[model samples]
Target: MDDSGLVSFFRVESCGLYRIRQKADGEFISDGFPEISKSLFDWLSDRSVLNTIPWDPKEHTRRDKVYCKDVHFDSYTGDYLFVLWFANSEAAGEVGEVGEVGGIDLNSKVGDTNNDSEKIDAKNSTGKELTIGKAMYYWFIPSLKLVASINFKHSKTDIEAFTTYIKKWFDNKNKHPNKT
Candidate 1:
């Protein structure tokens, strides 16, 4: 959970730049991190569950919900970075808010009322309407007061691919301790 170690790992493993924050002090550990889109940032920051939970450092958290349309960072590429907020243990037992999509919940109200229509209509690369649901994975390392997440399109394939990639990266790192 060392800040430098986390930064180094993400530098090598992430498809895009990752964000890391010191949970205890609200200090950002990521250098030159771009601002998350306003509506998306407000939506996540408003989640009371994220602030109330007593996160266990040993447990990794994953949540699937109808969160938002793809969130674009303030960069030239307009890259989408799924916002993975810290989750509470209680969230697993509770139901999410209902959304436009059937059987999925919007979870929270987006901040910008003017953009509600735009945010609700999530689409895929093919321009087909895709579900707004996303699977977010969060790691809360209390020992280091750090919470880190890397998010992408939600799918079984994407999850497996990320896992496999991380495993291989770790395997290589373990095999060559002094390489970095």
Candidate 2:
């Protein structure tokens, strides 16, 4: 193999999203550092929490009627490693809108619990200071939740840690199908 060894960190949070941090030192792109706590709203966008919408604005044009943001973010393992750097782009546009729209906000109430959440390591590696490759982020449908993400080996990304995480939003959508 032209490259040495490849590593990946999977941080799955309650926000319904999973983070896959890819690491390959020499062939890496972004710096290797754990993604700590990004803001709620921004995190959603950065995490591509809107692309999961199964409905198309041009057709249903729904997902446009909410103001979302995580109140808390925590992985099963809780790997609160130091954040190196992170950057994300959109294949369509923002998180929500019409065929041309972009952005995702469903009025969340996750609150400030994320700060106190446990900070677990990347399980295998220290996830301290390393190099990251490509940063991949995706979202779910209907609830417009975060599903899965993958970072490729590049020159700017930090893939030292893969802390699996899920988004726990406090929105109507988050409510069970059969509410009291």
Candidate 3:
């Protein structure tokens, strides 16, 4: 659906109209438009970005509409690029826009059910302070980037697990050996 569920269509500046429909896996497909062969559909369907959002359908919404920062199709390479991020409802409110990154208020008294000071590692190998509360997932054709953060109040292990699940689908769209 076109963000509203009234109809489904994707239009590109160069490419003409495309009729899209959700597949059984909650991924979308262009129903044989522009006379692309069946093989192309298989390829496109296999690379769906939705596979990276690691929430269980039973626990979360069906995800007909995902929280996305940006989405676009590269005309030069014929690859689709998109960024999906999660800021928890309260964190989203802090940043104003869902697209903003890293305005997580560590001191905010929200979603802070677990406050274990012992688990604080100070920083990860990358030198960035290990944080909790906000997470982001990005997919660009064959590359998938996932970062899960934890604040002082959230469980580092649990957020790590969620990020791991998101990483599991990184190769969902690879045409060759998928990048790790």
Candidate 4:
């Protein structure tokens, strides 16, 4: 699929900044525009940015209302990067409304090592029935060269999952460049 088609399938709300630079001799030069920067990359990678959607001057910050939707291509690295942004809070909870999103409570009985569907379902505020044991296929998006796919559920996605996705992307890019 092309870029537009991937965005449509993922139901992306906004596109994040992308930077493509090349090293000539020793100095790095921007490919074309200068909108994307290392700082923007750092900001996008930061979890705090995911929870900090702008709001009215008086309202309290609401992390529950926002979450990431999908992975986007990193032009320079040729790997898909997780980009988080705002979406309808209710829609965020519905299955298939968005892509590759899930929720979890770190303090819950579910340990970090296991994605216990029963524990996660029981802990989820949405109280939706668990679609456990279903094979999630989006883990690798070949069209976008994405090594990791996301599972969208009604729970807040865990930070470990995001980190794992990044690591997988790097490993795949290095070990199987064409596959990613």
- TM-score, every prediction: 0.20, 0.18, 0.26, 0.29
- C-alpha local distance difference test of each model: 0.31, 0.27, 0.30, 0.32
How close to the true structure is residue 97 of candidate 4, measured as C-alpha lDDT?
31
Residue 110's C-alpha lDDT in candidate 2? 23
Task: Candidate 3: list runs displaced more than 4 Å.
Answer: 1-52, 57-70, 97-165, 168-180
lDDT of 3: 0.30
Q: How many backbone clashes does candidate 2 have?
A: 58
User: Could you say which candidate leads in lDDT?
Assistant: 4
Q: Which ten residues in a row have the lowest lDDT in candidate 4?
A: 31-40
- Can you list the residue pairs that collide in candidate 4? 100-150, 102-155, 102-156, 102-157, 103-155, 103-156, 138-149, 139-149, 145-180
Question: Which ten residues in a row are the worst by lDDT in model 2?
Answer: 101-110
Backbone clash total, candidate 4:
9
Relative to the true structure, candidate 4 has a C-alpha RMSD (angstroms) of: 13.3
Model 1 pairs whose backbones collide: none
lDDT, candidate 4, equals: 0.32
Candidate 4's C-alpha runs over 4 A off are 1-34, 54-64, 67-80, 85-89, 96-101, 104-120, 123-180
Name the weakest run of 10 consecutive residues (lDDT summed) in model 1: 3-12
